[model samples]
Target: MKKPKLELDEPQPRKIIRADKAPTEGYSLVVDGHFKSHHDTVEAAEEAGMALKNRYQMLQIQVYDAVTKTRSMIEWPAPV
Candidate 1:
């Protein structure tokens, strides 16, 4: 018997690092549909996400780019 392929739906907008243009191209970190914090650069936003994940014991954290409209997941280390 042949197996069938599964199709996944396009991912929706989630936690993202929104790049603000009006007041400088700063990046903001969002989590669980809420605006958490803002950073001067994307790297800072990513680092903030990592800290938040560890501090809150989040299962997973996703990051999206406001300008490019792309998404990525934050890699979390396994608990010791």
Candidate 2:
């Protein structure tokens, strides 16, 4: 007797931040400097801060009106 082959696959969960409509007013994303781990949301950011050894600082982030795509960078004195 021959056995049938089995296929194994798993899906990974990820966070998606979407803007249905562009905001007339600009917004800011502040990440704490003490944050160490990778973050996908504000809650994750806080978790990263708690995990870090040093004091966390707020990182100032500015969203541009013209740009359609979002971009991120590592800044000193991170924000929460």
Query: All candidates' lDDT scores?
Result: 0.62, 0.39
Please give the clash total of every predicted structure, in order: 0, 9
Query: In terms of lDDT, which candidate is strongest?
Result: 1
* Candidate 2 displacement at residue 12 in angstroms: 6.8
Worst 10 residues of 2 by lDDT: 28-37
TM-score, every prediction: 0.50, 0.22
lDDT of 2 by residue, 1-80 (tens): 88987866766777444443433333323333221233345444444443341354344333232234353443444465
What is candidate 1's lDDT per residue for 1-80, written digit by digit as tens? 98998879978878554334322345555566555566676787788888878887664565556566554566676334
Model 2 stretches astray by more than 4 angstroms? 8-36, 54-80
RMSD of 1: 13.5
lDDT value for model 2: 0.39
Best by TM-score: 1
